[model samples]
Target: MGEEIGSDHFTQDDFREFGERLARETTLIRKLQDEGGLSDVGPVIGLELEAWLIDHNFFPAPHNQSFLARLGSEMVVAELSRFNIEINTPVEEIAGEGLARMHASISETMRQCASNAHDDVDTVIAIGTLPTLRETDMSLEMMTPSNRYAALNREAMRSRGGAPIVFDIDCCTGAGEDFTTSYQDVMAEAATTSLQLHLQLAADRMRAAYNASLLLSAPLVAISANSPLLFGKPLWHETRIPVFEQALAQPSPHQRVTFGSGYASLDLVEIFEENLELYPVMLPVCADAPDSDFKCLKLHNGTLWRWVRPLVGKSSDGKPHIRIEQRVMPAGPSVLDMMANAAFYFGVVEELAEYIDAATAEVPFEAARANFYAAARHGLGAEIEWFGKNRRRSVVSVLDDLLPMAERGLRRQGMAEHLIDKYLSTIAMRLASKQNGAAWQLAHLERHGDVHRLTADYLAHQKSGLPVHEWAI
Candidate 1:
């Protein structure tokens, strides 16, 4: 909510200024949510894919800057790490068999990526947490060499009582960034990575997608758990879970547990308002702004809600745009896997938009929230409330019911049946196999507790580009 593109810093007054800006922004979705009758719930869809680069040995490679310079910055963008790269797919409308086209584009991009890295780097694999990730690899030194990232990191850490912005990943190294173990274990293993998927949605459905996102979040995490280690410490199915939340958290007095009062995101208002309230402007503006204005609250109000938020921006036709951007999705096993993730989510949006009352009423928002945390805490093994009486259902059961609903919803949108089946079924298979990225990474780490060894094994599997269950078997 603070800033859409990115930012370098924010002063005390920027908050108040940005807050006022929010009041002035007339987003397209507000028209529908407020007026009710006719709205654009247009079958619009879009995607942003982010991935990490690895060396021939299958470890994080610091090639992002060089690659972007050589290949150009139109498609691939910079990520948190200089070793990481991001691809933004042109916005595609999920009309008819539109999803197929998006899938093909992603495939082509992957091929191009491989071709570009042919001899220079070994490969590029996508997963939530790179199994090979090491504490040394997460240092601020490797952070994307951008003024924006550094500024934001500096300000963010500064706000939280001067804590070291926690660049350390949880490894067996005694949970401290400073070396606690012997010299032999210095580097450990560090190639764990992820593919983050960003989807764009119409504003009216924003609220529905927001809530449903929480419900869908767990399932996606369960399926895409590729991050399972910090240094040598193996924890959580998707170890990225704790790290990501902590990294983006509002940095209040309490950063330990996310549940309850920490984040005031309940209904739409809390989500949007709070996002606008917390995040400091992270982008460095160039010659774009007519004048260099300085106002703390003013900048806060003027900034848009993007990624970690529901954003407001102007569209091609001069109309305002409001979109809910989901940042948690990790990179993939394949384009098919990534598209399936998108499809499953689209189905949820369709179902929720079409039938809001039933979803919200039947499943209390509180229960929905609880289910999400449970799924994240414990992957497929976690139990969920199905019909009634706290009936425990495996992650599979939840997806089984939801996958069909997604398919139906897609069909309702006039999407081709074959496409829906092909895509949604992938999600089903993902849950059934229980060998998602996280699951596979965890198993790999357990087999080879050494971080470096775990990372090497992860690279071996990624080099093969085999499905998790396929690799596991």
Candidate 2:
């Protein structure tokens, strides 16, 4: 979905042609899978951190048009809303200093973005959901000026048969009184931004990697929970979980950005098969690419925003490869925090993949999916089901038990011990303190600070280059 499209409008002929091409590509994918023809290029990792352009007052500043232009860098680009822009880092090999390199690259990009943040936009922030964001700010007028975004809004609205997009959520924060409110429009989706991590794996390992990612989603979201407040209401610990889904809600299952309907029984190609079967082509632009490109399949797959998305990419040599894009974590509180989150994911998923045989037998797909939502709703405070015990365990307990496994996984993968300890130790401290981004924000709110003050404090902590767990209220 990050790639640019040529046009917003498509003819019926376009859909038909796209469908024909998609079917051919899907078949090609299956043949490749059966023949073991997919690229064995990586365990290479990549990062995409989407952030907000805020004014000095901390309100979202719709100036990404000028801001991106001023940056004049391909690494930084506009998002669904003008107030948001995405910062991308080049893929780094998962070896010595790879995690540290990821952090350094992101920091450099942040500096570049800050250097070019036009006068109208104050600074770029990478947080789950901005506390100062108002319902009034979520209007069509705030959307980034792009054909793809316009077309997406149109198709999504059309999918709902022109019914208003509704965001009805009930939230209970122990410190604050529970609140429930409903919103209307796709712009609300713009309010939630995330830090998406991509790990390219060999085709043979795609299923194991994908399944492990799904199983780890709950504890991942719990420890990394950041979007606690939305529109000044204390919602779920990671409120963006529900907010983003409901903002783009449709009557059909295929159109929703989901945790997936079920686990993958086969290889990664099964995901594209499901996409071809269930999702109606939302952006059926006629493409002029080779059969190997699979533009039609790629575009359609992009529309289905699964938490852990299976993607097909071309290597430098133009051969096709597979990547598992992890979409569970939110963007900020800080760059080090984001890298720690990614390190924890890569390490745990690596270690957990070894247990896929046991996990598949012991853990049900439905339980894995439910655990994700439970964690998003309750953060580290959430209880999730693990493989050995039928009973649910606190997310904190889950992370504590898995920390050593992650360290061992990183070591086994040949990651530098210093880098491993530097990153995973942060996750360890977060588990010990039980104060992730969401917890920090909730604590501040409990200290009698208003949302505005909280946002300012968050930005200050974020700018200080300190992890959220160490940030004082």
Best prediction by TM-score: 2
Candidate 1 has its poorest 10 consecutive residues by lDDT at 181-190
Cα shift from native, residue 81, model 1 (Å)? 1.1
**Candidate 2 C-alpha lDDT tens digits along 21-47:** 999999998898889778887778999
- Pick the lDDT winner: 2
TM-score for all predictions?
A: 0.79, 0.97
**What's the residue-level lDDT of 461 in candidate 2?**
88
**Every candidate's lDDT:** 0.56, 0.86
Q: In model 2, how large is the Cα lDDT of residue 400? A: 90
Weakest 10 consecutive residues of candidate 2 by summed lDDT: 175-184
